[model samples]
Structure formats: structure tokens, C-alpha cells
Target: MATTTAPTTESLSDAVRRQSMAEAHTIQAMVDYRDAEMARTALIESSLRRKIERSAIALTIGEATGMSEARIQLRLSIADRVRDKTPQVWEAFVDGIIDFSRVRDISATIEKLHREESVARLENRVVGYAADHTGTELRQWLRRFVQRVEADLAVERADAARKDRHVAVAHGDDSMSWLNAYLPSHEAAAIEARLRKEARKPADPDDDRTVAQREADLLVGWCTDSDAATSAIDANIAVTVGADVLAGATPGFAESTDGCWAVPAPWLADVVATGGTFWHRIVVDPVSDDVLAHEYVGRFAPDTLAVALQFLHGVCQAPGCMVPAERCDLDHRIPHPAGPTTGDNMGPLCRRHHNLKGHGLLHWSTSPPAELIVIELYPPTPAVEMEYVAA
Candidate 1:
């Protein structure tokens, strides 16, 4: 009988290597599939919102169609980060153009280190420890190690598609704005259904005062004090300008005293409450009944006032244009309405747009919209060009 020879050591080693490679490939494939699915689902969701009866139903469709809000968010974040990078870089990495072992080594390095500082320290430590282990010199090894770390992270990210754990609640009227997230399908459904019902409910008085009316009354009581009017004419009307200007320039001379503008009691007609802040509707002269600029007051630090302005503007101040609010600043066109150092009549304006306002080169037609203060700007050499429109 012929004796069966055992497999050679080289053959066994080759088999193990092939098995590991196959496993990694399988993981990578799964990751790719999930990523594609997430992108498709997001697109589908966007289109569906235009035709759907309610926004909640759209979310239900997403859940029923095998897409999770968490996964969608994860995919979006990953796409955003890598979107700026050259597509070729990501493509080569994803397609395994580079060695898988090198990719794995890079991933391990990146995962072990917490921050950039930590990574630098580790690189130094690794170079010293593996002084003789690697064939390449220390400097070369360090460079390779860092490259591997970044490559490894990319590979791992490709494999790690986000898991479906929640559903996102978006604005019904505006499908673009995300409102909140929901854990369970039933909860989302119930909330959406209830909102629709409430919206459809007929205007009928059941009690003495509505919730809105009661809240309005409470606000009126808080803001419009009876004794405030008498005290304002008789005693000094107190106005809190920025502490810096009050301390630095004129300590005792109040803004309400003479030449400087002071916010009158009656000018604060209707206290518009929005987003944990109060915007006072102040009329410049009560006799002429001419309304001046609407002032927004917040409890946040004065320097961080840009945040509030951005929130108000929602986008670029330029009318009918849709530039993002992120790149805008609170530019006081005609300086502070109250003549304070900060945050009186500032609106979110782009740099070029702000310069136009500051140089007095821009002409703004002030008009109050129902819910917002609309400013229409006209630049010189105008073909009726609209400059900046603030809310």
C-alpha cells in the first residue's frame, strides 16, 4: 500500500494565510453592502417626503424598508469626513490595492492610540522597541508605521457600517431640518399620528382661556409692568448695555440720560419669545409711531452672540438666496440701535456683505414681516440687486 504523506509546513502556512485573507475580504464586503444600502435608503427617504402624507409615515417606511436612522446618520458622517479627500485615495484602499497586512497594522496602531499626541508618542516608543525587528531603518519604520496606522483606520471604517438602532424625526414642512430621534417604531408612529390629529383639530373654546392665551397673559404680566411707565418718566429708565462699555468709557453717564439711545418702555410693545430668548419690538418714536429695528436679547455670553443671530437668520441674509448660516457673522449695519458696544441691531452677514453695510455703501429698506424683521439691501450700480435680508 502507498503511504499518505503529511502536508508540508509551507502548505499549512499558506492555507492559514489564505483563510485569514478570505475572512478579512468577507468582512470588507459586508461593510460595503451596508454602506450602499444606507446611501440608497437616505435618497429614497428624501424623495418619499415630498409625496408622503405625514413625515412620521416616512420614518415608518424607512424602518419597514430595513433602514435604521442611526445607520443613516453614521453613513452621512463618514461620507462627510471622506468626501473632501480625493476619491482615488479611498477607492484604492477600499479595493485592496495596498497590502491587507499593512492595512491591519495601521488600524491596530490607530485604534490603540487615543489622540494625535498619543499617536506621536507611540510612534517614538514603537520605533525604539522594534529597532532591530524590522529590516528597514528606524526613521523609515516610523514613517511606514504612521502611514499604516492611517490606512488601517480607513480600512476599519470601511468595514464598520453603522447599526440600525433608531429613527430620525425631521421637520414635516421642511424635510431638510432634523428635529429629533426616536428609539421605537411605535413611539414615532404615535407621536406623528397625534401631531396630525392636533393640527387638524377645529378651533373651539373648551375652557376660559387657551394655553397660548394664558402663556401670553403671563408674559405680558412679566414684561409690561404698570409701575414701570410711571417710574420711567419720573425716575431714570434703567437700560443694561454691555458691562465692558459701561465700565470702560462712561461709568456714571447712563444711556437713558441724554444723547445716547435708550430703549423706551412702550417701544418694547410685544415681547416675542423664541428659543429661550426674548426679542423686544421697540418703536423709535411713539409720536411718529415709527418702529425701529427689532432687538434680540439672550442669556448667553455677549461674545457668543453670533450663535443667536445665526439661529435667527437660518441662512445668508441675501434675499431669495440659500447660502448656509455657518459662514455668516452678526454685522451691525448702522451700529447698535441702543448704541451699546455689542448685540443690539446685529444680523448675520457674510464678510463681503458686512463690509457693504459697514461702509454705508448698502441701502436697506426696513420692513417687519409677520414673524421676522426683513431688511432689503440695495448695492450701488444696481440692476435692482437685493443684498442682505435678515430675519
Candidate 2:
């Protein structure tokens, strides 16, 4: 029998690097082709409408590149911005540290801010972040970053969008339909919270419906009633906003307790119009709405330590896992008797990862008190890959 060797983790990591490098070179070629097309057509197509000229070029590139013209346009847009604005990020792309998605997401968000200083700040700060995180997470952070820096814009945008809120029904394949509502963030949060709270309550002993089914039933039952507005369900809003926001300064947004959603800073008035109060909990990771993410590196700190951990490690420590820290086991990076039970040695690992650690399949290595606790697993990340907690 012939024996074959399985590829090692190091080889897989190297393969990913090679693939990203190939993609980066390909994107650069696409960008060069677009520029060449524009220059070639400039003199002859000067009399033609700009959109028409671009469409022809886009179509030609699309045929040769096997990408749709629309998609080609988007790639060109992002590439142009990256090449013009953020040299560090562009260098990362060329070196295979980040890819086209990183450039795309960062450039798209960069288009939102009007201030030169803010754009420069984002360009300087985002390369490290975009490299370390997934696209979804980068998008979320970029949005929150936008809100922090351009609070007025975010608030005004939210206000403008709220005026267009309405309910619509879409007929589905079956006999049923889908109901969708476009409400302000806070109101939507309240509705969701109340439904979840209600669903968790005791139902009939014989009822086998899940909490989700219960929520759906309750939603229908309440809306079906003549006095739907006066339904018995109640929801408590647990929100946190910056001191600057409450003072009418646009520094950051008001967010829910679990960091799920954020409303504009000025909307705090609406939240507390009748009279409500706020308190500060020292989660040891208190984030200012206005500060950059890298500034708040974790150094062992408070919230009774447990609640602090909840706020500290927002997600599972396992590589690329998305499980929320609240749903994870408070795991010691170093085994007990060797590692203390303090925050320094402990972080959040979901059950699956924690089990892997028990079997010696996973490992976590910490740097100094101020550095990230890097995880060593399949497709090993750099030991310098410490996590961050900016808020």
C-alpha cells in the first residue's frame, strides 16, 4: 500500500497567503486595464456622455475578465480609492496580508466621511483592524466608527430614514405572506426585547411550541386585537450612551447593553423625555464613543471580574468563531494550579473550543499584560495577534 502524508497546518497557511497574493495581482491587473480603457477612449469619447463611455469600457472589461460590468465598476471604485488614499492598506493588499474584501469594505466606508482629517484617520487606523477581523465584523466596526466621528451625519441619516418607516407585506411562494416593518432602532429594539421577554414566560403545560413560535404567536395575537397598542407586554430598555451625547455633543451613539444596536446621540432625549436615569458600570473596558479601537488595550481590570470578562471578550477566543462571550465558558488559557483564575489567565472560550483545549488540541499564548492573548490552532495566527477591546 502507498502511504500519503496529510498537508500540515503551516502549508495550509502558506497556501492562503499564496492565494491572496494571486488575487491581489489579479485586482491590480483589472485596475490597470480600466485605466488603459479610460485613456484610450478619452479623446474619441469626449463627445459622448460619461456614463455611456464608462459602460462600454465596463462591458469590454467584463467580457475579458469574466466579471459583470456592475461588479467590475465597484471593484474599480474601491481600487481607485485605496490607491489614492490609504497606502498602508494598499501595501497590505499587495503583500497578501489583506485582500480585495478588506480594500472594498474600507474604501466603501471611507466614502461616507466628508472630512479630510477623518478620512485620513480611518485610512491610518483601519488596516490593522481589517486585517484581523472578518468582513461582517469590519463593517460593524466601521459603522460604529462612522457614528463616533460623524455623529451628526449618523443622527441626521437616522432621522431622515425614520420618516420613511412603513410596513409592507410580500406574498410568498406558499399561501402565506411576510410582514416587514421599518422602524427606528430603539423602537425595534423594544419590540424585539418585549417579544423575547414574553416568550420566556410560562405557557400552558401541554404547549410544545418553541420560544420563537411563541413570539410569532404573541405578535399575531397582539396585532389581531382591537387595542393592540395597549397590549400587556412590557419591555425594559438597557441602554448606554456617552456623557457627551447626553450633553448635546455629538461624540458617540447610544447603544443597547449587549452591543446589538445603536441609535443616534440626540435620540437620548426621546429615550429619557419623561425622565429616566443612567448609571456607569466599570466593565474595566469602558469605551469612549469617540476614541479609536486600539487605544483601549485590555490591562487586567473590574465589573466584579465576571461581568468584566463578558464585556472584555465579546466573542469566543477560538480562531474565527462567532459565538458571543456571554454564551462561552470562562476558560483559563493556562491550566489551573499553573495559571491563576484571575482575568490575566482567563478569557471566554465556547464549549466546543474549551473541550478542544481539554484534549490538548487547542492552545492560547498570552503576551504582556497589555497585549493580546493569541490562540495557536489550525492555520496558526501570529503570536503578536493580541485581541482588542475598544469599548
For candidate 1, lDDT tens digit of each residue in 92-170? 3344332334333433444544457645555345523432243233334444344334434432432242234454656
* C-alpha TM-scores of all predictions: 0.21, 0.64
Return the top candidate by TM-score: 2
Runs in model 1 with CA error above 4 Å? 1-304, 337-344, 368-371, 379-391
What lDDT does the true structure give each of the candidates? 0.41, 0.71
- Model 1 TM-score is 0.21
Q: Can you tell me which runs of candidate 2 are displaced by over 4 Å?
A: 1-8, 45-54, 226-232, 271-391
| Residue-level lDDT tens digits of model 2 in 226-262 | 4323344555565666655655644457776666678
Clash count in backbone of candidate 1: 4
